[model samples]
Every structure is written in C-alpha cells, then in structure tokens.
Target: MSDWPPHPEAAAVPSLSDLLERYATLRDTILSLENEKNELGELIKAALLRGERAETELYRSSVRVQKRLEYPLERFREVFGDAAALEAASIDRKKAEALARAGDLDPERLREIALVKEIQALVLTPKGS
Candidate 1:
C-alpha cells in the first residue's frame, strides 16, 4: 500500500482551496464584463437621445418658418387678386391636413420642411407666382 491515503482517482483532482480560488477569479471576471456591457448600453442610449433632441429642435424651427411663409403667401393673394392663388391655397391646405392626419408633418424638422416648400413652389409654378 502507498504511504499516502488511498484515493479512487489517484488524487489527480485539484485541492479544495485551489478550486475555491479559481471560482472566485471566474466570478470577478464575469462581474467586470457585466459592468462593461452596462456602461456601453448607457452610452448608446445617451447618444440616441441627443440625436433625437437635435432633430426635434430642427423640426420645431421649420414649423415656425412655415407659419411665417403662410402669412406672406396670404398677404400676396389678398393684394394680387389672383384666382389661381386661391386654388393653390386650397391644395396646400388639403396637403397640410393630409400630412397632419398621416403623422408625417414632423413639425420639428425645419430644414426639411423648407426644402419641401421650395420644391413645391418650383414644381407647381402657380401662374406668375
């Protein structure tokens, strides 16, 4: 018989203390990875929020400009006495109402709104407008 105590597997397995130490190391590693994941998630969320806010501000500015354009357009019609102007306004009102109903107005995107108006003005080219 050997001097050491007999073991079923010839004592090849690691000691209890060694196993405990390995387990602690693995646990700490998992925790660190989790923390890193959380930090990255927070960073992504904040960046998205900032982008949304900027887009919203631009849209709001555009809405204000669009309102100003409407006033001038109305005044021009009042002075010029053009029938086509009234018809164009009817179309514009319908479009605005449709956009509103479709949730596509996005009153916060001013540059895009202005571009749309400019394009419409060019395309429609109301007689002598």
Candidate 2:
C-alpha cells in the first residue's frame, strides 16, 4: 500500500485493473485475519468452558452458560394443545409471481402490495474458473 491513494497530484488516475488488484489483496488479507481470529476464539471458549475466566491488562472475558430445550412439535402440541401456535404464511412467493406474470394472480395487486428492494453488488470471480 506504499502507493495507496496513488498520488492524487499525479496526472493519471488509477486504472480499473490496478483498483481490482488492490481490492483483491485487501480481501484476502481480511479473510486470513478472520480465520486466525476464529481459531483464537475457539481456544478461548475451550478454556472458559470449565467455568473459568481469563483476563488481560485491557480486558476480562468469561462465558455464560445457558440451557435451551428442544422437542418435537407433536410433543409440544400434546402438552399445550394447538391454539398456542398458529399457521402464519403458506404462500410460495415465486409461484405467486409466476401466476401474476401469467395473468392468473392480479399483477396490479402484486405491485401494490409486494415489498420492493433494490441492491447494488460488485462481484469478482477467479480468473480461470
């Protein structure tokens, strides 16, 4: 990154190729750091798993134990009955869109009621793949 910002006073702006190369390098570094961080996190959790605590000059860390229960829905229904939970949505959105486009479902109604979202993405693929 010695040439980072690419000398703003220079006559030439950075090419897209140069910008992409820098972006890829930074992304790889971030991924490597993330992997190392995750490994250290596992070690910390293992140490704290025995109801232990650890501290450094700047920080103290401890793990809190929690219990969660899991059971079959039928078991729950038998114990509590059906009224506790209600069916929410059954619509398959893609099918609904296809029907709307084919003039089965109302297109105007879909447009009026559908949630709209728009996003921009920059994607980089491996050169040979």
The sequence of per-residue lDDT tens digits that candidate 2 reaches over residues 1-129 is: 376866778988889998999999989999999999878877777777666677665566655454322323453334334542122112334544565577655556545445443332212234344
Residue 19 of candidate 2: its Cα lDDT?
91
Report the lDDT tens digits of candidate 1 across residue range 1-129.
Answer: 533333677757668887788779879989999999768545644554455322332232111112223323454345433553454464364554454456644334312333233211101122333
Query: Best-fitting candidate, measured by TM-score?
Result: 2
Scored by Cα lDDT, where does model 2 land?
0.56
Looking at model 2, report the run of 10 residues with the lowest lDDT sum. 83-92
Off by over 4 Å in 1: 1-11, 52-129
The per-candidate count of clashes, in order, stands at 5, 0
Clashing residue pairs in candidate 2, if any?
none
Q: Alpha carbon lDDT of residue 50, candidate 2?
A: 60
